[model samples]
Target: MSRLPTRTDTPPAKPDPADKRAAWADAAKGVCIILVVLWHVVVKDYLQIDWHIGVPVPGLWGALGEQFLPLRMPLFFTISGVFAANAVLRPWRVVARSRVAGFLYLYALWLLIHTAILALAPDLPTDRATSLLGLLEQLTITPSNLWYLYALALYFTIAKTVRRVPRALVLVPAAALSAVAAAGLLDTPGNRAGLYQNLVFFLAGLHLRPQIERWAATANRRRLVLTAGAYVLALAAMAVAGAQRWFGVWPLVSVVAVAFGVTAAARLGRWPALGDRLATLGRITLPIYVIHMPVLALLHRLLHAPVSGLDGVGQGLIVLGYPILLTGLVIGVSLALHRGLLAVHARWLFALPTSRRPAPRHVAAAR
Candidate 1:
């Protein structure tokens, strides 16, 4: 799979211990993007089903799966932060007209596209006056997963300040806040939301990347321990969530678990057959993530068998398993699409400009 974006690859090279961190970070991206695919594919479809499996997802099966949901996006940002931490230290001119401004440009373009689509959707909010002013106001704020981009721009802008401060010190407070969020003590504005929540995941992922890499490469003991412990804690929490929302916290814990969990899974790559499959799946995560939804939706419509309407044990499998099967189709198609023809413009989808754009000649300044 292609490696992620990093500042070190640009102009003056900085030493990136790119060996293990990059590999595992790539692995982490694969894992998170699968979780991203699953978020839409599994949960979205599963919720539509009135039925459960034999027992329920509530026990071991459901508990195991729930861990990745909350922590995935933040992990992506954390990985981004590890990269972003280096960028802002460049000259101020580079920081202003370059990094943050360029991201804002992309944000505006995408935000307009995203909101415009929703506005154009069927039977729009009639009483809710859909004014251009409101749309513009909403763009200034944030939209759906669009906040990730905005938050990332901010992280890149202020990364130097974060890098200067003790990473351990910054992470400690964030971890504490995560703990609070986990404990339901500070469950304000939703645990998955706002500036504060993302900071916790971003810092944790950045600070913990080195440690995660070391654990991945080393004696199997630590990784195994982290995985088993995370599962036990996660399942137990999910069991608790049967009554309350505390089980929601295990999803975050599971993210931590998977960082370790995949280490054991990575060993599978040593075997020629399994290894090749994993590496290939990991490689196509970017394109698959971008377009997985339309594929799943299409599959759901096409496979409108009576099984789709099943409730409980029968229902969950059909509803959930169908997407997983289709996801394989999406991945295969995305891979084939890249190889067959679309490789020419593949860069456009994973697009982010490299060099900073020149500031528009300010006529006022010229005056």
Candidate 2:
């Protein structure tokens, strides 16, 4: 099986570590994390009004969320795959220490934090298991929003095991699994279904990293236009099929939508100022992802009714604007909290408690 160049390669010119941190990739991640927070806010804050009032209220926000669902998590997992491409080539111990252990640590830590919060707050609406056995089941099976972290650990393990296999062989079965999951044929409980559904895109990202990198490097106006058109069409098809309740092929459409979505995000990341800001956001996505939910939940509890009395355009503006505003607030607050935690020697909040050697002279000098 052919492989992309790894850090082990003896190239004539060393690639800049900074260049390895692709601005576009970071921008794509930034867009993904923002969308995630926005989706959660809209669902919990705005759309819950219908449930709260005991009527199915029609709104553009819910429709918009449904339409973009395919792109959101799929894009996130694919981007993760792109980063994992190189990591998968490293030794098993290194891969375990860095990717597997890192993700598991965060997942376990946050699982406890979220469980404790829900347990302590009796008024908060939580469907999570509260009984000892139930809590054990949840810890073992369902991971909630932290499912992505768990999925990454699983994918990394699988990737290492199958690293010697032909890329096409690996991806074909993975895609089939995604299709099966999307089609509702797999019927696994809880996050297992999501794990299956997203595995293909992650594998595609890992297997096709070289091709994707080459395409991005050489992408031009025509390719961008074509990709954008394809993405729009895919979303339209998905919408129509979804309305008809045709579930079997939604994952196939999702694959196309995610491919184009990543492409579009990459192109948009070329803008200097916007890309820089997004790249910075991307760098802190982990903390943002972990912290944003609690912030949104608190904000939702405190201000869920602030815009309820508004009408027409005022309602629409609040519905649309509040999420963006709250997303900004969540990001800002999360960053501040992260910095404060770091300042107080609370790095364990974000990372495992470990120590390492100082940076190499050349790498530090490059910075």
Candidate 3:
């Protein structure tokens, strides 16, 4: 059995000066970004199964998606909620400083970048800058995958505001909100059923983080080996079924089930290297996230004819690897960028003791 990953420093109660950049949540976010990238890689060029020579494997693409659909954007929001839970009562400046500086800026900035791509690309559906729909359209649907950022920002802002409410109260309303959307009476940003799935996950993360983290700490190191295998097997089963749309009544059941299964597997004990690197990658998952669509699309378009040997199954593996690799590369680059950029904007991306220190008693009390 493999040993669980140990946090050498574990970001101290106040995370030391030298340890400022280390973040556990960041690594998980990295995993989430990889999943997002993989989702796009498979779904985009779905028609090119024969692009790979002879393998007639059906649903290889969706099988990959099915294993990971549970992972996708929900975990990211959930993790964000976990960290933000501690700071919900901070002054407005703090929220704007950290979450705004990190998440909001990324959202607004990426929105423009993607909109530009959709505008100039011949392959992409026209945004028709001159038309009324174009103006409203940008607000309605995202270029492809960028909407999650904006929606996340909105959710965090709202969650932080009334976070003082009882956990039960908060959960009930969010659940009701979700039920309304599920019933099709309400809508989310992307016009998908059960939108703000990410927000609900985020809320869950905020409330459940402590318990979840502890569970990770408590799992037997040896069990991780079996649990990891079991997780993969369970996912494979779910993936195969998902490809056939087998559950009959609920297609997304695979996603919900498998995601929980993976979350459970993380406790089996992460390899120190994998976990640490993933944590590092998670911190910059946002930029890696934005980088994925263009990166995967370009790579798939470039490799389509040449890599035809794998058929769909082979191509499926390539699709899976691209996001995982690209996420690491983009985050590696972004982490450097964050170092330089954050020095100028430290208050935005991280919390510092000086800024986070407690207030002193009133001086008039000296009398």
Candidate 4:
């Protein structure tokens, strides 16, 4: 196995201080986080409940959500992979202490918190193991929303191990494997299958960091036009494939969508007001991601039932508008919970006690 960087090994150059690369990355992450939250709220909670309660489900939001599903989580892992590029070049101790430990802490913490909540409220939709052995088994083999955290730890470890390999050697095989996995060639369970499906994008982000950064920096109009055109073509192809039941084509379509989505986000980051707001949201994405699910779950319990005397359009409006409202509420409450409650009262909600650090200088500017 490849070992981590040592004293003799030169560290990767720090990200350019003058470059707006991190800002664009943050903006991308911000957009992704919102989509994730909305996907869960609209698709998982609202749509399912609407179907269960015999309400006429609106096609608009559901269609839009499905269209972006592939890009959403893939963008997240890609951005994370980019950041992990920096981590893999650090000393082994730093990598272990900072990256591995931090992710594990949050994963374990939230897992237990969610597990406890499920155990206490057996009436909720979430299922829990009744016996201690069963609980341990679940904990070992299963992770709910916190699977992202688990995958992050695994990805970091793998990235470090392969740091010495030629980028093409690793990336090409990974991409092929991801395509196969996405096409249902991987026989793993859902969560594990997700890990396999996303692995290529993560590796691509890590290996292609230099090229990606260059892409972000340049103002290449031709490249933008080409990317947009390709994305449109891919979208059409995906729609045709879906209608024809050609599931195998989806993996490639997903890759194209991700590329276009990331580039678009970078372009959008050039807008002053939007970029600034997105960067701020991106900075706090961790807290929002960690806490929003529980908030949404609670909101679901309260809001799942359909109201009487509303027409299909009115119900559709409520179905659409309510989730956005819940999303905003989750974001706002999560921010307050992190800053007010967690920051002072219980910092361990999102971090290990010892892992806490002072805010970065650019944090203020991002806000």
Number of clashes in every candidate structure? 5, 0, 6, 0
Tens digits of per-residue lDDT for model 4, 1-367: 0111111122223324365777778778889889988877776565655432245444566777887777788888887887777779998887776667767777778877776655543434543456776556545665556678877777788788899999888887777767777667667653666677777878878889888777777735666677778867877777775631244465576677677767777777777678768866766677777777777666666666644335566665666476678778878887776667543656557655563587898996788
Measured against the true structure, the TM-scores of the candidates, in listed sequence, are: 0.66, 0.84, 0.66, 0.82
Expressed as tens digits, the lDDT of each residue in 1-367 for candidate 3 is 0000111112213323233122345556656666665555455544343454344343665665766665555556666666667666678787655554445455555555555544443342222233546545644553225666556556668777767778888776765565455445544444344244445666776776677565445556465566556556665665566433332212244335434533443531255556655655554454455545544445555555566556566666755354355445534554455456445754332221134454456644654
Best first by TM-score, ranked: 2, 4, 1, 3
- CA lDDT for candidate 3: 0.51
Global CA lDDT computed for model 2: 0.69
Residue pairs in candidate 4 whose N, alpha carbon or C atoms collide under 3 angstroms: none
**Against the true structure, whose TM-score is highest?**
2
lDDT of each: 0.51, 0.69, 0.51, 0.68
Model 3 regions more than 4 Å off: 1-24, 46-52, 96-102, 119-121, 124-132, 140-144, 179-195, 221-270, 304-367
Our model 4 lands, by Cα RMSD against the true structure, at 7.7
Model 1 residue pairs with clashes? 51-311, 51-312, 52-312, 52-313, 53-313
Task: Report how far residue 230 has shifted in candidate 2, in Å.
Answer: 1.7
Write down the worst ten-residue block by lDDT for model 3.
1-10
Q: What does the lDDT read for residue 282 in candidate 4?
A: 69
